[model samples]
Target: MNLRQIEIFQAVFAAGTASKAAVLLNLSQPAVSKAVQDLERSIGFALFDRSTGRMVPTAEGELFHREVEQTFAGLSRLRSSAARIRDFGSGEIRLASLSALSTNIVPKAIAAFRQRHPQVAITFQTQMSSTIRDLVAAGQFDIGLTSDEVDATGVTVEPFAIYRAAIALPEGHPLCAKPVLSPPDLHGEAFVALAPEDRTRQKLETVLAAAGAVPRIVLETPYSTTVCAMVQAGIGCGLINPLNAEPFLGRGLTWRPFEPALYFCTLLLTPPGRRGSRIAEDARTLLMSFAGERPALPADLHHVPEG
Candidate 1:
């Protein structure tokens, strides 16, 4: 019999009378009686004893009800699962981000997301921008935060942020005197370079070359966090996304604006045709909230008061 028929039988059985079942089901008494009669005909057995003036369950009907109870138990579980998926997402969110954002902003966004949806599980990975693009395009990751340099051939792309590259330096460094710096200021200075393939690095190098500003290269790294650490360690100075410098600001590292502005463009990547699960999309919204919200730093970052 159909679930509607089974539902009618269940209501009639629970309520103990056709009139009561009609009140419970929001149907008329005659309709409820007809539905119970239809169920008995479909199953080829009477569910209620007709000899009694009041409704009473038959022995066979009681045995059949045990199975109906089990069926509804499973249906209850399905309803709960659907509720979770609709409200908190499909249980998990998988996200990958480039090191530039992963160092500071992405982690903050994730923390906020968790506070809002504590039940949603998150899989967060820090990879190169190109790798993030690849993962998103292949449908291996639900969302990707990457630099605009990655080829968008396989995934849908949108601008997430564009942080102006800043000059990261050790405290008390001489270059700190300038409110804003340009390629000429770094000439012959010790420089910690980003990896050769970095999109921002390529642009900065082009500007440095055109201006004949050749800083003495000290070390090379792919991560902006590492660049900040090296500058803190007195290894050298470098141009990095200021978002990566926030955690290091109080730890002996500082940053200043760079002129002829070089920007670290950030992109949001997702599978082209379809969107990600509810939790993943929720995380994407949180991440976008961090855009352009950098804390204001003092202009004379390197001029720490003698303490």
Candidate 2:
């Protein structure tokens, strides 16, 4: 009915019980129950099937809750926009990033951005490639960084950084003694394949197939950080983007560049047709300036016109 009632209804829908909602909302169970009843009465329908001291959303209630969620999301964005207007330099920028880039590349970019706009609040979430793309496209995030190339229908993607792929080998692995490793060097060796959907794995596979090599895969993981850990334990060697592999250099692991070069570009994705807030625009500029010196850019970016 009202914003307060809508908020209470959402909490009840989420918590599934008046008592639990009460605890979450810091209200008494009766108060929570009263709020939900008031909302259902205002809507001229029962919002829940109340039988066993538990709340189960009615079919209409479920639909109503989904709408409420969307409404609240829009309200939150509006609130953020208003706060930005009150203080242009200080506002929240929500971002989602693939796990590999989240650890280093994204953090480094955020660090550089914060140096200039110290008042801007940044919230970063690390997720798998698909999820990051989805969140950004859904307006849940202002920006997304990922190694994967996304074909999101309403999102604009721009290359932000390039990471050369490297192979991480256990100290005793045969490739450890080699200064450089070619695809042939990895031939028949046991490997830790990243998830089949991972951009890094696909690139590595392309290079391997080109070099007439089919590796013996021994492990697979979604997280590059976990793959690094697996390599440290001698579980198997892995091919990783340098951004994720660089920090694991000396912990019983050795890294060598793949002979047939493999690399992935880090892309910054934003919802289409939506300009970033001023602070976000400034942050993007900072990111571009810092990322320009990284591997992904062509040699001529120094002279290229700015976007």
- Compute the lDDT of residue 189 as modeled in candidate 2: 85
Tens-digit lDDT track for model 2 on 183-269?
A: 888788888888887776887888889889888898888877888788888888888765565566666766666666676667888
Please give the CA lDDT of all the candidate structures.
0.85, 0.77
- Model 1, total clashes: 0
Q: What's the true lDDT of residue 161 in model 1?
A: 89
* Candidate 1: tens digits of C-alpha lDDT, residues 1-307: 7898889889988989988888998999889888888888989988899677767999989998999999999999889778879886587788999888876778889999989888677898999888888888888888999887789998999999887788998988998777678899999999999999889999999999999999999999988889989999999899888878887886788888888888888899998898577787888889999876864575455432211
Clashing pairs in 1: none
Best by TM-score: 1
